[model samples]
Target: MSAPSESSSAPRAVNPVLAAVAWLWVLVPFGYGLYQLLIKIPALFGG
Candidate 1:
């Protein structure tokens, strides 16, 4: 078998704290929107 290629090598690592913050950056607003939807859904259903 041929040796591994550069493109096929393992990917670089990321900072864990930065990753967590990036995820929260996206997820926090999504979570808040979901929470607001849950609060409004019952109003739409009339109960």
Candidate 2:
């Protein structure tokens, strides 16, 4: 384990599928909330 740092200084690549899933996990609820807020904006001001 200690010898790993001595091998190279290259950055690790992220898994594309994992990155997509992670982004979806964060964006889904955020998108839903934004959609709901937009739907409610007209009623909030008596449109």
Candidate 3:
């Protein structure tokens, strides 16, 4: 059996713009969910 090659297994580099956009895509929803949880949860519970 042959051993795996490192050169063939390396991942392709991500584009910076796409990476930034993807990070924002994740962060925006996360931040919004946190905002709603902080502001809405207590109201829903009548606290």
Candidate 4:
């Protein structure tokens, strides 16, 4: 026999505040990187 694992537990509801924080954590860096890429793109094309 095997011991029960975390994935064997029932699903839980996500906390909205935590979800928002997680999104911000991911998006802030992504937005900054995208902004940097956009600024460089024009230079790449010699615009």
Q: Which numbered prediction scores highest in lDDT against the true structure?
A: 4
The alpha-carbon lDDT assigned to residue 5 of candidate 2 equals: 72
For 1-47, candidate 4 gives per-residue lDDT tens digits of 77888688789987899999999999999999999889888877788
Give candidate 3's whole-model lDDT: 0.87
User: 15 in model 3: Cα distance from truth in Å?
Assistant: 1.8
**Model 3 regions more than 4 Å off:** 1-13, 40-47
lDDT of 1 by residue, 1-47 (tens): 87878678679877799999999999999999999889988877797
TM-score of each candidate?
0.61, 0.62, 0.49, 0.61
Looking at model 4, residue 43 earns an lDDT score of 75
Clashes of each: 0, 0, 0, 0
User: Ranking by lDDT, best first?
Assistant: 4, 1, 2, 3
Name model 1 segments beyond 4 Å from true: 1-12
On the 0 to 100 scale, the lDDT of residue 12 in model 1 is 83
Count of backbone collisions in candidate 2: 0
lDDT of 3 by residue, 1-47 (tens): 67887667669886899999999999999999999789877777788
Backbone clashes counted, model 4: 0
Which run of 10 residues does model 3 get worst, by summed lDDT? 1-10
